[model samples]
Every structure is written in structure tokens, then in C-alpha cells.
Target: MTNLLQTERLIIRSWIPERDAEQAFVIYNDPEVTHFLGKSSRVTSIESQRQRLIEGIERMHQRNNGTGSWAIVEKESTTIVGTIILKQLPDKDGLPTQDYEVGWHLRRASWGKGYATEAGQVMLNYGFSVLNLPVIYAVVKPENHASIRVTQRLGMKPIGRTNKYYGIELLLFQLDAPVKIEESSS
Candidate 1:
């Protein structure tokens, strides 16, 4: 959708595979980073990542909604540090539901720098304010304390573990939209 979102310290924008693939590969190919994301999400080579991102970018455009993945960039350094996503949640049992998820994935170097939380906060604003979604959910693996803490920082409340999404048990968190979206002059 070419929507550019900004936080005080980060920029969230669309993926340019040619420019973003290398750094994205470093994150997706790292065992430590991908451990909580599941085995199928791993990238084997830069070429594969480039191809995947190219396809992903196309799918994102086709969806044409505000929901999809966005590249997270560090403001000062102008480096891509991660991705923040707000998208439809895949149903585990072929049931229809209005479940959308908000998530973040930061490179190891960007971890603990509050970038994830910053990007997440902005995306929440976009989802609730721009998209007018009633609520947004976050699904985190139980042991992914870092991500869980980010959700807490974003003001999401735990709704207990469930296998209703992704066909696996995950700790679910939810946040209902505020009465009104906060208006900003920027």
C-alpha cells in the first residue's frame, strides 16, 4: 500500500527486496532468530530470500489492505533492523473469523533497543486508527519472553494459550481499540 509509518526512532515501510534482502536474510537465516518463528520460516540463501520477499511484496500489494508486513528501519543509522506485521490470522480449523495479528521480528543487533516496541506501537495506531479494526491480537510462543514483553509494552493483555491459530498452541494477547485514535500533526 506504500504506507510509510514513523515512530520517534524507527521507520516502517514497504519492502524493497533488492535493498532489504541481505539484512533480512541475516535475520531469517539465523537460528537464534528463527527458533521461535518455526522451522518452515527459515531462509536458506540470499537468493531464496530475495525471491521470497519479491513474492511477498507482490502478495502484499494484491491484498491492498493496510494489513501485511512492513520493514522496520532504524532512524539514525538508516538500516533495516526488522519487520512489523499486522495481518489476518490463519485459522487452525478452517473456520471463518475476524482475527488479525500484530507481531514484530528484530535482528539480533536490534534486540533490546526498544525498536520492536516502537514499531509495534506505531503499527497499532495504524491498525486501530487507520484501518478501524475493532481489536488486534498477538500470538507469541510461551517461551518467547522478549516478544511477550513487547506485547505488554504495547498494552496488550494476555488471553491465555490457545490452538485456535496457526494450528499450534500459543499464548494469546489482545487489545481493543480506544474510543478514538490519537490524532497526530505529523
Candidate 2:
């Protein structure tokens, strides 16, 4: 249940509502950040967001498999810049698709910094290593070129588009578990 992970310059840790709600509100409220996220508008109140954050944490903990949204913190500043998520998405039939997804959302100020890709790589590593998944997936809005690039940097290839996610069509990208090669000796 402990899902703390580290990268060269970032610390990916579990979401604590009390500690993260304010920063999360700022990230979630930014229209530019939420534009591709499918949120209708900015979150208006910290109280409401706190409720949502509580629920989000509960859902992740419910999974009980170290899969959930975690705060993306700057190692030097100790600031919560954004979140990186690894979780399962339901299929069209409302059953588990058995597909784990990797995604990131950062504050506008934090954009253009390679944090998303940095955090994403570790999450993918954890998914494949700790979780032992066969393949991981990402669904991005077509117009969000920045995120598309992150997925590309993660070496995720576009499989296709589908409306199965959140009832809307999205560009699907996937990365398979790395195949190991063995040395042959004469």
C-alpha cells in the first residue's frame, strides 16, 4: 500500500488530502491544464476539491496494489508540481479492461520541463516490474500535443482511437513489457 517512488529530481508519493488539496486545487483549476482533462471548468472551492481528493485517495487505496495518483514533487523545492497516475481503466462493458494506464498532469508553470516524462518512466517501470503487467496504456486527447509527445518519449506507440474511455473517443497509445535477450555462447 505504500507507493512512494523516486526519480532523479522528483519524488512520487501518495496523495495526502490535507497536504495536497490546495496545490491540487491550483493544478486542477487551471483551464490550460484541465482543457484536455475533460473537466468542464475550474474547481471553485478547496472544500469541494478536498472531498474529491478524499474520494480519489480512497479509490486508489481500494485497489490496494500500489496503483493510484501520486503527487509529483520537486526534489529541491519540495513542492507538489503535479500528479502521475497508474491505474486500471474499465472496458466498454463496465468490467475491468485489465489494462493499466500511465498518465501525468502538471501545473502550467511546470510545463515544458521534462517532469512528466521523468515521472512517467518510473511509473511505467513500477507497473512492469512491481505490478508485473504485460502492457501499459495511455489515452490522450488528440489536440494535446505536449502530452502526446510525452507518450512518444515513453516509447508508447499509438495503437488506435477509441470511445471506450470515459465515453469519448481518445487516441490510444501502448507500451509493452520489454523483452529480454539472452547471450548465446559457443
Candidate 3:
């Protein structure tokens, strides 16, 4: 597993079994953070959540060749603050899909500090450059102004609304190929 990926203030990396349970409790147990995610209450069982995190890490390794929902760590303290995921959606005709999905969550303590936007931009760069994906997508609830703003800040434009995997109404935003500069011949 990759040890670290960095933004200006954060480090995105693989889940450490020791640190993840507490981090999971912090994020999953918060009602405000999980509001649009379809869960009604905070998950109380740390062991179960820890197991789930391990499973997710394993599954991500199997799926993406060692890239997936990385534990977003604070650079100064090296704490697991949240997670950032970049994954491909299933394809239509038995072929792999090029349009990837990006998502993130942070502990309440980390909110309102632009960490999400910073980490998201780093993930987007990895997606387009390392993964060579042509486009990336994000789905957010219409009322999730913070998430929508993050998407907008990344220069992702709204494509449409769709029923997400959790059966919630979500606004789809997409970022295509990066803009190219044209050279003028005098």
C-alpha cells in the first residue's frame, strides 16, 4: 500500500488498522456528516466499523491496484481526519468505465477549513494524470451546499440529477479533460 499522498495541509494514504476504528467512529457517528448518506444514526460499534474499514481497504486493493478511499490524515499531527475515494463506476457493455467517481468526508473538527477542496484537487490530479481518466464525477444532495461548493471550486459542472446507489436524489457534477492552451504563430 502507498504510505502517503499529500496536499498542502493533508496526507492521503492507506488505512492503518490501529487508527481507523477511532476515526470511523468520529465520522460515521456524526449525524451531520452522515446526513445525506442515508444513515439515521451514528454507528456505535467500533469493532464492527473497524472490520468494515479493513474489508473496504482489501476490496479497494483488489479493485484499483492499490488506490481507493484513502485515510485523509492531518500533516502536522498525522491523525486520520477522514477519507477520500476515487473509484470507477461499472460499465454499460462489459467494458471498464472511464468516468470515475470522487467523494470525501471529514471529522467535524476538520470542517470549514477547505481540507475537502484541497484533498479533492489532489485526487483529481491523480485521477487524470496517474489513472489517465478522461473525466471524473461527483454526486451530492441538492441541499448539500458545502459539497456543491466544493465541486464548483474544482471546476466541475453539473451534468444532471440521478438516483444514487443509496436511493437518494443527487446532483451530478462532472470534470472533463483539462483545458489546453493554444499557441499563436506570428
By TM-score, the best candidate is 1
Q: What is the TM-score of each candidate against the true structure?
A: 0.92, 0.91, 0.85
lDDT of 1 by residue, 1-186 (tens): 354899888888889888889989988998889999999889999999999889988877887886788889888998889989998888887453589899998889889888888998989989988999999999999999999999999999999999888899999999999986579999
The best candidate in terms of lDDT: 1
Cα lDDT tens digits, model 2, 1-186, are 244899999999877887778998989888888888866536778887777789988987687987888889998998889989998876766466677889899998999889999999999999988888989999998898999999999999999888877667899999999875778896
Candidate 2 segments exceeding 4 Å error: 1-3, 92-95, 180-186
Model 1 off-target regions past 4 Å? 1-3, 93-97, 181-186
For candidate 2, give the lDDT of residue 35: 88
How far is 47's C-alpha from truth in model 2 (Å)? 1.1
Report the C-alpha lDDT of model 3 over 88-170, residue by residue, as the tens digit: 65443434355578998888899998999999999998887777777889988899898999999999999888764344567
Higher-scoring candidate on TM-score, 2 or 3: 2
Error of 3 at 4 (Å): 4.1
Which run of 10 residues does model 3 get worst, by summed lDDT? Answer: 89-98
Better of 1 and 2 by lDDT: 1
Residue-level lDDT for 26 in candidate 3 = 86
Global fold similarity of model 2 (TM-score): 0.91
lDDT of 2 at 53: 83
